[model samples]
Target: MAHIKSRKHPAARRLNCSAAVALAFIALPGAIHAQQTKPASAKAATEATLPEVNVQGQAQSYKSDQVSSPKFTQPLVDTPQTISIIKKEVFQEQGATTLTDALRNTPGVTMLIGEGGNSSARGNISMRGFDTAGSIFVDGMRDLGNFPRDIYNTEQIEVIKGPSGSEYGRGAPSGTVNMSSKTPFAGNLNAGSLSAGTDKQKRATVDLNRKLNESSAFRINAMAQDSGIPGRDVAKNKGWALAPSFAFGLNTPTRIFLNLEHIEQRNRPDFGVPTVGLPGYYNAALAAKGIVPPSKVNPKNFYGSTSDFENVNGDMVTARIEHDIRPGTILRNTTRIAKVQHEWMATAPSGAVSDGSGSAAVARPDPNTWTANRSRQTKWQKNELITNQTNLTTEFKTGSIAHTLSTGVEFIYEKQLSKTIAGAGTMSPANLWNPNPSDPISGYALTPNGAQSKGDTMTVSLYAFDTLKLSEQWQLSGGVRFDRYSTENNNVMVDGVRTRLKSSDTLAGWKLGALYKPASNGSIYASVSTSQQPPGGSNFTLSATDTNINNPNLEPQKATNVEVGTKWDVLDNKLAVTAAVYRSENTNDLTTRGADPGQIIQYGKKRVSGVELGVVGNITNQWAVSAGLAKMNTKVVAGSATQTGSSLNWSPELTFTAWTTYKLASGLTIGGGARYVDGMVRSVSNTANAATTNMLNVPSYWVYDAVASYNVNQNLALRLNLYNLFDKEYVASLNNNGNRYTPGGARAALLTANLKF
Candidate 1:
């Protein structure tokens, strides 16, 4: 008896009730694979075909064979660097929510938009070319501020790449981004989901787990979202999140885990769209002499200030413990505490003028009322962050060599309060070739002209790491870290005169690596690392000149990286490929001072050289794939030749990504993907300013996405997602002198209903 056929519709008798619990989980996995291939009778196949039990969990992939990093405990094809992982069912089948949509499945990762026009929930990525939003992390700790990140209790994200300074400590010479929460197991799982599409999207998510007794356990995850940001205009986004977890002695051997998290956000800020006569211009011979250019706006225009606003709040607490003290030795501990808050009010755009016989270019609101210019400005900010971390891990062996160890200590506290109000008012810029958004001008006000700045910081760090095998295909690893930082700053004026500054520093970082396997799924590696930063390395402010950070001849800003890599685990291991070639350098940097004129020196130097390729998991078993590629070359050999050979402002010298999925036997599943970048450089180079030349580019683009699912039973499921499928409008982010720009989100659709019990 084997009959399983069902595909009826009339809206499946008007679904609802959570699509009838997602059609019984899309019909219980095709009715349990048709009752395990029916024909197995013959008295149950003459009994006894048993005696083949091989269960070694964790291996179900769309890429991600293994990763639970606290700085590699092996398996990621044998980790030596260049990690990626995405999981969480590939951003829940691509209806991704935040973390820049799961970093678009990685390829030289990117995202930058938040030049303080506020609210993308902070964390403005841009890896490999630096600016790693302070290297992110959560679970592995450090999740400072700049808000906006939710993957509804994410269960995987990784990243890792270059430098990583001995596994974190003043990172970002291009690397870092962890995330990995979602715990409590001993299962009895419960899941939930609901979503709606288009610019008026709405979302809800929940995941609950329980199992009290026989070891103890509990888990909870929640999220809520309200959206709108298709073609921009009045851009909007709202958020909510909560996470709770607890576990005690699960599976015994002494264990404990606890977690708590809360997040909130309110947004309405999109300071994008405008780049004077666009299209790669480095003053194209001053636009062939006639100038002109500035008219086809409408990527859903909405030039700020409709009561601009952005607010975010976050909190976290974590604790972990493990103990075995025998049988292969084990002991682990983790601790975390976090707090964050941010506030904002923004309205920006100020550049563009030229309109007398050079034909056009008008953005006037006041430059004496039109020497041909456009204007708008308003800024206000507040930020606070607190962090703490503790770690210890262990493993042991001697004699035949084998070791794995980790030790950590960290603490950080940061505070910032800022306000900027210049010339107090200006608005009314339209007509760079016909414009009018109800043109009106005046010194628009949002208050806060109190000019103030306050900054505070404190940090303490100590770290150590080790790994070694030394046989059966050798292995070795190393790490070291130490830090001591301090800062205080205050500046206020608007007639309330005040100024203060202080600084302190101490730093060191290191790493080294080697590995070789040859077989057993292949591996080959080489590595070197170093990192350092001081002088308020990225905010925590400090300046009273003398070369900043309260001078004393300030110093610290060094980097070095050298890499070589390879990893393979073809078919039988279910895919997993990797490759790398690298060179990274910084050597101080902090130019100027070619003999005073504001003094500052650091013998400059910059370099980047790259090649990377990756692939992940399943090539069969219903197919699944993940892909990446990157190519790079950046230089500045000595420094200041207007950036010597250019290449660093949002660096992008090629990138690529790919994703795949397939499954069917009636339980349906489908997928598609694409992403490409290449075309960057829009600032940082001052050959005395020829508009910072290198042709001021940004171009290069490609995007595409699609997904489908059905499951109808076993617990219900249904999904559909599509994004920028064909409406590639381009320009996803830009800032750093090329006057704003953002764009990039034009086609959208989403529909989901999932339920599991």
Candidate 2:
């Protein structure tokens, strides 16, 4: 949940469910033979048998045929819903070092400019018209904290869109993002990368694997980086991380795995620039009297001083065991413990330049000596978590029907502690146009005052999924899950009074799907799914006030999704094409009172309907491509005036993403891609189509990136990445309040040397 702060910077969290997956691979041969059973006399005689099965050719590296989760019984093409996966090779080739950067490969997802420090949510994000900040997972477990995520130790990232409460215990109504970790395997090798680039970007990484024996292996990965944002002054990122994993019984029926991770980050967080001149920008001070139109400030200006900083420490330990009970059955158990601590002090710039004494608040007013007043924000937070999961997967036959079933039980405990630092006094204003990072900032907040909070959640979950192959061309799938959770909260107000609240409930969710095969390599499917989100289930905070949505007494919000789609593999099984038309409807159980004043309502509804198309894999042996496009229609079926409209805040109507690469026979490769986001409305101070005193809508923009690499030898290569190739200037994202916005990256380059042994 949002309240938990990690102990430090985040590192790789892998080997989640690895032990069981490895055991299944080792038992594959026996599984095929276990299906046979006969009387001794009949078995001895020459008898009928199943035909041998053989699969030829390898899938392209840019495409993934299957997902890491055990719940899905079919390949990505045969599955009923849409799933977007970004493999390590893809992001690495693009020089995408963070989770946000890598996610650009997928459409229908948008990032949010986070709110103020006093907010409980961190690293806000939206997908399919819903907030998904709390639905990010690592190795099948929730990953806490709202900060930039590194990808050095990640294998792949999978985005499962739509209501999937039956797949995971609790999550956002939109969807979930799961990151698979890299674990030790039966291999021996060493590899790494060293890079230096513009904006003082310098980075180094190392990966080493050692084989202890035929059945055991150990691996470790480490990364260090020091970088600054292009076109932005004083904003920096510095971090180091290490992940180590050990595996035993790689070829046996039973396997064991242990994984550990740690990371430290000392960074200067960006607060973004003032949105004073963007289209739709409105200012109360000037709107009534019609003062000089505001002047556009430089997007590169640094609004924060050198004292602004964000320090993080994150650590995790995981242990797992898996056993092959029979040729067709697997039993797996995994346990993990993680701790994270985060703290930050930063400045938030607001409004046009003001001299703090009544001078006309305008950019470069008179002699351009005007200064902008900035608000100081500070917080300290920590998060602690532990979880245990056990699962069973088996294949069986009931008369003429064949089935694959997966069942699991899980236990979790999580806690978050947060403290707000009170400012000692007001901060001196800084020059609006030419802000100086060296400007001395005094009276900043350092120590915590009376404002504090502590939240805890405990959960027990049971889930089962089954797929029935009715015939060669027909399949039916269904899943059910129940979660019994308890939450408690403690808050201390500014007056030093502590208040405690607790809530408990049981939530149920289910999904159903059917598939029909038109040919050997194509399928058409239809599905229905449902999910629920309880009050405080995402943010981890409970309220006693009757009007607050997080009040424990409120009922859980509900969501339902309906979809029809088709998938196919073409071009000699080297390429995949998919299309889906779907609708998702969510009904929020209000706080016994409507969001609008002087009104009451039991339920409010919202809907998002869209069509999505995707293509991935290879057009030829030498060329690879991954692309997706989505057109969405969002509407507030019933809600407050500000929230009821055809367009939801931050939800764009159309988005597209594509990346392609062609390999040359000379050991050289080159690729480039473009992304587009439609203009988004700001619903905070204005209606869906009306204007306000601030930027009512963010302008649509397109950005381009390219990469090229040349192999010097079998073990060494040189690579270069160019970003924002056209140097497009646009707003990347804006805060919900519409006062601040982050600028898109300017033209930049990075040169790297890759090594392997």
Candidate 3:
């Protein structure tokens, strides 16, 4: 056996999509041709000499005991970090077509309705009280843009909690969500499913794989879906995606893999329900002044145009190579390029109004006194991201200590082009309580406002990590990373004035931890980590000041995470239990400076502390379960006016999720689960006034779901999924100001037919 050696190479220049694809074909001609010319005797000899190719297709149970990580060289249970894994089986059981649907099983995670609606790709997500929308990754590479993600090509989803700066450079203070893609294996396999459900939902997905030779294989996954939301009028969703992948030199000393994906979506966005009162709890005061309360309005009512639409088109390509220099050393390199285009026109809620004067106010449904206003919004943008990462891992022993070390370097370039269109549209105000849909309203027409912007960013990072076996029962781990980032933005306003903004920063991140193994199946660990996010870190768009293109003295937001956790494999290694308690402190957050007008300051501080517990795997030979619970507290310790001591918006205090499945002798399996999210403050103000407190609060809610599957034969199965089992009506998400809300869907059922060969 040969060992892989670590080496450094100059950063590769970025290439266009066509050029990259051409280069890939030129470089892999030998590998591809080898697969095409397969003599029977040669194939037999090659197969006998080559090692077996192993792939984890789909798990039979809902639980996965092990997780995959590029940064760590140890098993997940011994990595001294809090990580959660959602296997493919869980997606099939829940009939989850989108990423949002699959995320319901994870605790401490919440969705934020995007600009267009729940179905829009622009929606954000919060994890452990911090926004992590920009921290999403595919196979450890950054996934840029806000495009709706489908699970048709996903193998598993992993959530790693706490500051992960050491593993990923920059902007991972609250952790990261990584989606693993399905890949090719040396075998012949085909699987597909068709599903139909309420709300006129229809979906089909297929996975096909074939081996071209003993060491080469190709695979593809494709999906198409059309659906509508229950209880919402004219709100529909349609999308399709195709992913193709190829692997060569499988199980050999040198290997190469290529993957390409394209997705397109068109949807009628939802704007959700409106607040009862302007400030929420002012209903009584408004009612006293002759204003109608929000209770009179139905939650399912539609106030937007039927023609409003959101569209997204995305493309991604990845190439990876691995070489084994020796038995305990390996080297790998991966490159990914992606492009996404987004366009949308939405009728957003303007405001709620009523005719009232002090104590004489009396609310009514008259258009003059209570009406809903609509505003048309339109935007067109294009984004491109390119990243290349190379790493080497080696194992060695010095004296009595053994060590596993990993070193990596990465480079990323991202560019965005945006155009803005602004125009006023004619819309007749509808009565708030007794609105008539038949009322004639003028169609909206938008014109370009001469507002355009272009943004570009470049980052170079270097990282190293090591795990030392200090003793049979004790292990020590440490890692560090350095990142140099630069960004430039050029903007042209409606006034025909051009402005340029540029910023650059060099930052460092590190982590250290110690683990103690009480037994082969149990470990206890404690760790501390730190991360930072420079200005424009989230989207690479900077703001300009009068004296400078960008604020030169601005400091990056910093965060510190401290955690202690324990993991145990119970039921004879059939089930795993993990628990952790942690606290995160964020400082140097950007805020307005009251002392100096027009100047921004970095004087804000906030803290989030939580305890989490998770259990997964089989409780019995025929039963499997997955569950998690989290309790968190978030508060601003120091901040500007109106922000000090306030609670972070959308940071719920408690969340729980559970799912369990049982299989019978007759080849039938049944499962059910419930998800609960505690009410949270609707804004960062944390107002204490009784009259306004209720208005600023989001009511808590619980939803239950069930699934039943019957195996018709060795190659066929039927599954039924019941969502929102009790038809619970609740608010799913709200805008920052608490004026608009995205309501949860009503009860719906889906039936799926699955086939495998």
Candidate 4:
């Protein structure tokens, strides 16, 4: 949990690729491009117009070579980092609907329930041993909400690994997740899908694109879904979304785009099953009473009353303009405004229940007659974001060296408002063993106490990047970014008193990379990058306590990463193979290891090192595949192992995922994939340190999924997906306290008819 304030470390003070192996390999035809040394007729003018990084298209439908962000300025094979790019086609083939479903194609990522005292952060997650819910982005701009994101309008997803402050502003040390929206393309096309499956699942999606003229196009995407958990009772997910975009002067030197999206959701929230007889259950009070731990409750049990609900709304608008200054030079500007609103109410079980009076420590000897201590979570909040960005990309040669450069400036304004609520209001406890939704003594209503809080932030950032082709086989790339920002917080506490807090700071970050092309389609590379997190950077709320990490007076946390890797495109450029080894070190964590309680120090440090391997694209013209594996170790190198933030609390030692499909040339295709997550210890360090929790670990698990499709005609197809093919019972996610868990889905099936014209 340490943050390095400077861009350079002691040994790293001196420094900083093959074609990348991380993401699917498509191609980026625009932006900074490398200039060719050959004759002008040999893609020369375009080379000078292209960035130093490059790629070829066709053959492999499962691979993409470049990211949506122009900041990269190079193809994945040449970039020295661990990245995962998932295209809509991949997930669509698997019948995936939500962001969570799509992310299963990668390794080193895990889900999270909320902390002990907070409600669940529905779509929250942990990656590479750090919380990353706050680092989600869309089309290069930050998405402020933690709500579950739908992929109906998305073209592809990019999972950028390691600290990446040079690419984005203040962010999670673990990395960032970015989604690229589907936009207008030439030609008239209409596509849609209708699906039905287990748990009464029903869903539909539509995508339409029209070319009005040679210079204009229009597109729209829409989706609706209603589904229920296979094993859990009284839990369901229902939502709808629409995204529309228009483009003008697409083939001209100047082009403009207007886009917007809106989504609505209503769902039944599940707090999860209790942990009494699970692994590592040791309760002193119960043991002293000569009572043994009772049998674990069924994973299908639902603790919340039937009245529980979660409602959410998300909206976004974007405007973009792009101009070609010259054959190889392009300038672009983009602006966006977005907002998300969330409200929820749910019930959770704590321990043994007491008389309606709510007394303390009530333990019942009769396991069957025991009652659960019911607690309610109610929330109402809104998150807003506004941002503008401008960039210039151009390629040129200086002597024998060719260069692709990109520079940009950005402005952002973000806001959050929260309403405080207290008290469960006449709600009664449910039976410990089997709770009934109808057995409620309800006199309950959504009521907000006289308390509220708001946070606002304004920021401006400037950045520049350049990729240099030193020779036919050597390349160097680097970038630097500076961000200036200010934040303010206002609160109206329960006491009817108001308090105001403010913070201002500047953050500087950068990265360097070097690549040596062993072959035209392959490379070996190395890279170093840094990320910074200022006070209140994640939530935008400064704290009054000097010892708190969010205190305005505290220094920004800094994280540095070092990585080495190789990438190769083989079998006539149809298949890609990649491997990398990396170490991310965060220094200067705030801790009172040897100091007084109120006086914190910044000498603590934590580190996560790992190896990653990936393969994507077609093994043969008729066969496509994608797969990844990650192995990591997290440790509190220089702090109290049990201290919060000193080490990762939910990092798994190993994770693996894989998928493949083959077309039989008879209009039929078959594919299947597997996912494995190693046991996640709830302790700070990877060492043998026991965390303070009844459930010390979430056991490792494996899940398999299968898919098959038939192309009935040129514009029609039928696809079927089988999830949890073996119906293996396991834990999907666990809360911070480890006393509750979300169970993995039971075996289920989904059928869909795809249409296009």
lDDT of each: 0.69, 0.79, 0.77, 0.80
* Segments of candidate 2 deviating more than 4 angstroms: 1-60, 116-122, 292-294, 353-370, 589-596, 684-692
In terms of lDDT, the poorest run of 10 residues in model 1 is 6-15
> Against the true structure, what is each candidate's TM-score?
0.32, 0.89, 0.87, 0.90
lDDT of 4 by residue, 1-757 (tens): 3222222223001000112423333231111013223332454466567775333222237888899998888888788788899988799998888888898898999988775222364577789988888888899899886777889999999999999899898988899999999999778989999999988889999999999999999999999988887788789989999999999998899999999999999988888877766665544445545677667778788887788888889999999999999988899999999999988888776545222222223345778776666677788789999999999999999999999999999999999988876654545666778877666645576678989889999999999999999987899999999999999989899989998999898899899999988556677899999999988888877777755777776778889999998887666456778888999988767754643333356676778998888888887777899888887888777775346434467788788888999887686888899998888777564344232225667888889999988889879999999999999988888876666778888899999999998
Model 1: lDDT of residue 304: 61
Task: Compose the digit string of candidate 3's lDDT tens values, residues 1-757.
Answer: 2111111111011213324433332333233334444543575577689996542322265666655555888887788888889989887788887777788778889987655321242367888878888788889988776656788999999888888888887775788888999999999999999999988989999999999999999999999988887777667879999999999999899999999999998888776666654334454445454654545357677767776777889999999999998998989999999998987877666345544434543445553466776666676778899999999999999888899999999999989888886653656766666544445546446677789888888999999999999887899999999999898988899889998887787889999999997665667899998888776777666775522213434677788999998877655456677878899998876654454342445567888998887877877777888888777888888765677778787888888788888888788888899888888786676444433212577777889999999989889999999989999988788776566677788898999999998
Supply the global lDDT for candidate 2.
0.79
Q: After superposition, how far is residue 745 of candidate 4 from its true place, in Å?
A: 0.9
lDDT of 2 by residue, 423-464 (tens): 634567666677776766667547778698899999999999
Listing every candidate in turn, what is its Cα RMSD in Å to the true structure after a full C-alpha superposition? 25.4, 9.1, 12.5, 6.5
Minimum summed lDDT over a 10-residue window in model 2 is located at 4-13
Off by over 4 Å in 4: 1-60, 116-121, 288-291, 351-363, 422-426, 441-443, 595-599, 641-647, 685-693
Candidate 4: worst-modelled 10 consecutive residues by lDDT: 9-18
Q: lDDT by residue for model 1 over 456-560, one digit each (tens)?
A: 777788887888988868889888888787778888889888888776767788888898875556678898888766665565556666544334246666788
